[model samples]
Target: MTTYRDAGVDIDRANEFVEYIKEKVKGSFSQELVTEFGGFASGIEVKGYREPVIFSSTDGVGTKLKVAQELGVHDTVGIDLVAMNVNDVLTTGADPLFFLDYIAVGKIELETLKKVINGIIEGCKMGEVFLAGGETAEMPGFYPEGVYDLAGFCVGICEKGDVITGKEISPGDILVGIRSSGFHSNGFSLIRKVLKDSGVKLTDKIEEFGKSVGEVLLTPTRIYTREVKRLKSQVKVKGLAHITGGGIPENLIRVLPRDVRAVVEKERIPENPVFPWIQQLGGVEEREMFRTFNMGVGMIAVVSEADKERALEILGKDSFLCGYIEKGERSVKVI
Candidate 1:
């Protein structure tokens, strides 16, 4: 007879991992939360607001985790997980209320797991959301050794009428782009292909960026919570775009209203060293580059041209006027 552990699922180790995260999750508790840890489902009191709508998002770190595993770095990817999910919720103009995570691995490393939880805790703090509860599963045969996968879910609340979808976006709305530090957790498969074909390793430091290839690749995804939440109440934000996998053309246009096309000057996007380095090394084409990476601008804000200055002032240093909306097909033009 085959037992669960014999079948490659170690229940004991999974339990230990769950216990390991208990205190960390509990530390992020808020007064609105009802339950913490060891529950089949997390519970929270949905109170406040005249009329409230709950917005939720679920996302993962994607293939970026491969670099972390190869480089023996287990932290920060948790932030990427949180950013991916929370930022998506922010697109709906909701305040993130709580988050849950799912971590699966072939084997359990206490130290690495601790570091991972630490990163998640840090991410929760950054987003100002409670860490509700999560699951950790050890499947020895399912994943390769020292390899893990991370996924997270975030729930946010917004007043019923205050949620900002792109429905209100109109022609002539100015597009404000917030700069990204590097490749914010998308298109790592292309990155890995480029690096592998070019015989590049994580240990090799690219002179242009002055950091190891892995270091640049593993930079945590940025949290736009502070910027979006701050500006939402004070400005007429017609739409918000979280630049991820499909880059600007695909991601930005998703939130654009019909009959509104955005004209983005290519020169307006800040070019960073790693992008060109990868392009020159891998012989990747310009169009593929824009489709694959953030190319410096991360999150975008579509607001009436009248409120442009106030939006920039509210977003502060990292924000800039990247482009403007025009009357055309619902498309993004990179001039």
Candidate 2:
């Protein structure tokens, strides 16, 4: 007689894993999280909004996970997973309320799962969102041993009138860019290819980055929730873009009105050592590099020229006046 355990899915181990992670998960809870673990559905209180709008986003860390796996580091990927989703909802001018995660692994590894959970908890704390619930699935045949995938779902709320849809964006809006920690979890398909083709090992130390290749590559995606919230409160933000996969041109256009185009001054962007290192190693073109990576700027905000100084004051020294909006076809130009 064949059993589920014989097929490599151990029911007892799954139960034990859930029990182990319960407290760590609870560490992220805010007062809004009403339901606890072992529930069919999690519950959160809808409060504070006279007319509330719900904003949600789901995303994964993409191929960056393969690097983490290669380095035997599983903790920071969880933070990257949460940052991807929370930052998306933040673009809508929402306050992140809760987060849920999905983890699928070939087999349950208690210590590894614990590290991931701790990372998620840290991300939730950084974003000030609740760790409401999540799922952990062990499917032996679906994934190879010692391998897993992570995805996250984030929910946020804003007053209906407060949504930053970019409809208000027009010509003369100054674009301010916030610096990124590093790559922020996109374009790794090309990154891995470049590394492999160049024969750079994960353990290889590069003096420019002041860290090993794996350390730089596995840098966690920055969480922009707090910065964005504070900026919105102080400035009249007409548009917001979270730079990701398609980089500046692709992401900034998402928030521009039809009559306006974004003019980003590439020279104005602050330099980061890792990007130049990647460019040298891969021989990637400037255009391709901007299109593939954040290139130092992680988030961009459109504000009226009159409000630029105040916005910068709120964003502090790391932010830069990257460019402005102009009358034209709906597109972005990196000059």
Candidate 3:
């Protein structure tokens, strides 16, 4: 008489976990979420637009999870999961409507999963996106004990005519950079390699950080949905780029028109101590650092020089005049 539980898949515990999650995250669901938790699929209403364009994005936290898992802190990674997905859809000037997550682990660890879910709920509230639903998978052999992975899916809606394409970006357009909240879920493979080879411990604290390496590395990614939404309402944003794994040059060029070039004043990107610390510690080159990490600029907005002042005002003190579009080939130059 063999049972699923005997195979390390506890169906009973999974059932209880579902019920526990239902109780924990109900408040985070938005008014537009028509379906309740534990449903096979969730539905959301897209109202307020005569012609609505739906956009979506999916992302994960990458290897940053290793640091979180090693530190026994499961909450912040969930926020990273939401920020990565939500910010992508926001690049298109869309309003994030709903979100779903997938969690896979070797065993059903109640304490760990609870913290992860709570973080997701907090992220949803912060981003104003509804927590529609998600899945929890128990795979014994596939994942090691106490180890898990998370992925998030986001759906956003925008008015069809209002979609922001870089087509409008031309020479003399101003580029505004919104500061990042640390690395924002990219470059962890290099981060880990640097950590291992450079001989830095998570518990170690440097004068600049004022916190342990673990705490700094585990910082939650910033969600720009709110700031972007407000900016678009007033300013004529020609293009927007969400700086992620590829950093500025790679990511920003995607929104550049073929006939122009963007020259980023690298000196303009606010100084973040962690980046300098990593470069000095690992002896990494400046070019590779910009290509791999955000280097403190998380999002960039392209606007006509006329709207530049208004855009900066909306982005507030954290924003800076990072670059300007010019007539040249379709690429970004950070000098």
Q: On residues 1-335, what C-alpha lDDT tens digit does candidate 1 reach at each position?
A: 88987777767776777787886666665644765346687677777789999999999999999998888888889888888998889999899988989998888777888888888888888887888888888878789878899999999999988988899888878989898878879989999999999999999987867889889898898998888988998997889999999898989988987888989887876677778888898999999998888888889999998999999999988888889998999899998
* Residue range 287-310, candidate 2, lDDT tens digits: 999899999999999999999999
Worst 10 residues of 2 by lDDT: 27-36
lDDT of each: 0.87, 0.90, 0.90
Error of 1 at 117 (Å): 1.8
What stretches of model 2 exceed 4 Å from their correct place? none
- What would the per-residue lDDT of candidate 3 be over residues 219-308, giving only the tens digit for each residue? 999999889998999998899999999899999999998899999999888898889988888999999999999999999999999998
RMSD of each: 1.6, 1.1, 1.0
TM-score of each: 0.95, 0.98, 0.98
